[model samples]
Target chain A: MTEGFDRIVAAVAGMEEAARSFSDECRIVFLRNITIEGIDTLLTRNLYAERIRPIVQFGGYGTMVQDVLAADGAAGSDADLIVLALSVDELDASYGSPGWTSHAASAQLEGLFELLASRTRATIAVHSFIGPLWSEQGLIVAAEDRDLTSQTAALNRLVVEAVRRHSPRFVLMDWERYLRRLGAESALDPRGHYLWRAPFKRAFLEVWAQQLARVVCALRGRAKKVLVLDCDNTLWGGVIGEDGLDGIQLDRHQYPGRAFFDFQTTIRQLAARGVLIALCSKNNEAEALDVIDHHPACQLRRADLAAWRINWNDKASNLSALAAELNLGLDSFVFVDDSALECELIRQLLPQVTVMQVPRKLHELPPLLLRDGLFDTLSVTGEDSRRTRLYQDQRQREQLRSAVHSIEDYLRSLETVARIHRADNGEVPRIAQLTQKTNQFNLTTRRYSEQDIRAFIADEDVEVFSLTARDRFDSLGLVGVLVVFIEGTEARVDSFLLSCRALGRRLELAMIARCLAKLREQRGIEISRAEYLPTARNAQVADFWPSVGFSVTGTADGGTRYMRLIDGHAGGTPTFVTIEDD
Target chain B: MTTPAIEGRFFRILSSLLQVPLEQLGHDTSRKSCQAWDSLKHMHLVLALEEEFGIEFDDAEIADLNSAAALLDAVSRKVSA
Candidate 1:
């Protein structure tokens, strides 16, 4: 084996003991037509970074349908995720024949997905079939007759459409991408395929397992949310202070400057996709700002950044300050810098952040940045694309804050309006995103998936309420979510959270009052109980329940439970804010 | 490569793939002696050895590779030739 593959195998071999020590387990079951041995170790190595241990099992081979059907019974129902590692060659031998049809195969696959969706709560990731390595009818005949190549393409399209029916829970694992990355000729192991049922070589299996682990990590809300960048030599070609604005190389047509320009363009695209970009540079603030604003080749302007620190302060402290300003944990950050010293300092001091040192070869910068799957997400919501705008709007609110005299004056002048309504099908994705990403102002700190929220919306004993806040400045779309479970006139708040952007507006109190009123009027819930489960990052909300007029009923190790009796006038909406039903 | 170097590389790859200690995997280690060396693990060992030594073993030769000594001899012969 090559040295790289040898190192990977060595690393995976050492993960067997480490994988067993994780407290939380992500169980996965693979149902395939081929043998895939030693995959569990590879998956464990990939997921070890997230502190989630994976327990992998193989359902019987060539029994993909039967395995899923049996999972609804008591045997395989405990799986947290299911992977369908199937190939078209094993499924249909007559695929490229004269009159071969896809009707029966498509119907069977559809039925299998339906059974999985209805009977199981596990997340399903099915591999898309990579087309055959060679056409059976040769090049010209295959192209003319629309043989295996075209037929497989059509079947893949069908799989994509089918998976879209149950998105965010059922995802398509694009095996074709892996095949392209590793050429098709070397990816297939003919000896292994003939000796055993396994079709892929060891090298292909290693990378494929890592890709699958990336999808699993993204689904579990472990994807990084922020990208912190360095300015000197990282964003542009030279130091802004020494080289000056006109002297620095940042052109679109030149050699070294062109590479930096392309890198900045990629960073801009990342910002547009909802990654909050921040600049941490040791240069003078005025010089860097002038260069960013006036340079013709600067693709990332000052407005593109959500936050920046262009001072001489140490970057570890600056990153902490940025986290405080953005109201995020240090774990959600991916910091990139060109200086080896700065990257190493951040790696040692702020070990929570993923740090990347810019490669010495300038041309390799952009592609290397995109491959790590650090920012992978299953579905990007509208709120994500509008994230930079939301931060900018927060800055506007802060400006308004400084102009006003008192807190009450600021609230009254802003004229904040909060709309509380029962969540519908369209709001499921945003609600799930909030539960996964919000940490600072969350009362219970319970994370949920879109599938879990949908289940709650359909249950008669549970209610999911979403809050959207708007004022004179801008609209924060779907900023809050409250989920309550009711049992015999007693309502239990399962989750109560507001996005960090909506925290200082006294909207949480408004949401609680409206929730109590609605539960009393619609669901006949008389007494409401809520809990404050303190996490490392959510200590700011320790007294949130009492602040919202819920008296403490019980207390455990650092966790407080509060209960409130529903009267008509208790904890009314704040005087400055208006509450309405949407 | 010399005979000692080839043997060292073979044992290292074998020990890693089988999850056994290098000292524990000597000439006596075989499919029957080690419980982890099942049919599935045997296939993994063959694949790893083939890729490491840049050699291919036919079906009959793979079946004869039952012990560490036999596997090292096969790799040494192939690597020297």
Candidate 2:
């Protein structure tokens, strides 16, 4: 989203006051073996636009490895991320000249990776070496293994292999792929290199900053999660009401029909990886459902969507209803429609939702959606693959609730069980994700990354627990996370949040009681402290701590603090819910 | 004097990139006159000028293209050549 070098510079210059408005701050350290003075300005400008305050530190030129080694005892130890940007020429010199054999160069690179792994605790991102555009070996460079090009390939392989060993913490930027995409001639300016010791062109830096900004956004859990689609010409060639199931042009054999088929296939794939799909169509409900149910060429079915609003109502109201039914914030939704009027209406009514205007030509739709990077994610978990099924099960439970007369009988007959366990390494990503995404029921909304969660688990005084709920319908996966900091005879709850799907069942009370019982058994804690910080969406939990027998201690900075004695108050677990500990 | 068309568009880009008032930039405007025109911004100005005029500058030309007058002269020469 960064425009150009000059625009980015102007944005960075005005960021001193703009940065104070952001809630999250990320510390990034840059270590390059070349002159990289321009990168900081570019990165800062883009990051500030995303509500991320970047505290950047640049090491001296040509001292990447040395600075990483010195970071163990220096101020860089506190950095959340460390980026190593090394040019291929500098790497060759560091590995004892380009004349060294491929095997020897690979061995030296492996040692450097090992040193870097042992020396730094922050997440590491290293740039893969870009091969020189002009190889003196000419056509021989394509034939049997040459020196410079082959050495670059070997080094890139070593970098990728190193990342595999230290997965989820070490990542390679793949500058070789970036260079190929940008064309090597435009990416590297020989004149800039010789004049100012800057190896990359200014234009290349503009794109580089944009790519890194996406990575940073994904790491911070700001990726969009829901895709709200329109039905008429947006999904198929014609309106479902006019073109019936058999008349719509969605087949794979035609011109525009094939494009619609491919777009539907793309949307189906995104659903498979936990992106919630919803439909908002201004048409007869029976007609739309018939097309989705009976169309042979349709890749998406009614079951694929978590919810839908198929009526003659305006799209803005339908979208609002869909967000409420799914228990997701509007900010997490991306709306795609082929109608310019509809897109403009939603943009004005709900400014938080990301609106993507589909191009008039059907063939241009898929590429435009794919290139936006709206649904980018760094990693996927098993829970993501089972999201649609969980929502379907939730609908079944709602039906069962209406049939029963009493609330207690409905809960007891469903046979709900709460499984509580200490969060381990495998569950760190989900825990961090819940902390970032859960807004309605979150107390003291503090977002953490997987790296931050790992640090908490490694500490001696902190305790992290994850909760899972299952009933007659299906397993809800890890839906709750609670973090506590213990000191001698007292403990403070750092964060407590539950997924919206897991709420309204008294699961919060059960989870907290289990945590208290464990703390009393392990640390003999007497009291617990909790706080409720209200946000625009988290007003639902403003009085949650008080409802659980925690008395108000004080109020500060628009947040209420509460404390409760835990000497004999550990048995607050509700009777209808069964507890299973792992 | 240069053509009003060329000067009008050139000052618009300068004002937007530098985040300064249009009245503040003139032919004599240089790094010393504009608070935003530091060495880093100077490089960005060169890139913007190259993109606006569709001309590539050599290292010597880029290094010398500091003031508003120098940029206009170089771009005019490249446009008329």
Error of 2 at A543 (Å): 55
What TM-score applies to chain A of candidate 2? 0.62
Error of 2 at A565 (Å): 78
Chain A only: list TM-scores of all candidates.
Answer: 0.65, 0.62
Q: Write the per-residue lDDT of candidate 1 for residues A1-582, one digit (tens) a residue.
A: 354344456886577687678766788888887888767667777888678888788877678777767636322777888888876767776666675656566776787788888878888887778776776666566544367667777778888987788887788878888889888776777778888777887667877788778787886777888899998888998987788777788887897998898899888878877889988999766567766766778889867888888788999999999898888899999999998999999999999999999899988887656777788777778899988877877766775754544456546655689999999999999999999999999988888999999999999999999999897557988999999999899999999999998988899889999989989988788899989999989999998888778899898767888998998865757898999885
- The local distance difference test score of model 2 is 0.80
A2, model 1: CA deviation in Å? 4.2
Candidate 2, residue A237: the lDDT equals 85
Question: Which regions of candidate 1 fall more than 4 Å away from where they truly are?
Answer: A1-18, A71-75, A98-101, A139-145, A397-582, B1-5, B20-29, B32-34
Per-residue lDDT, model 1, residue A261, is 88
Candidate 1 DockQ score? 0.18
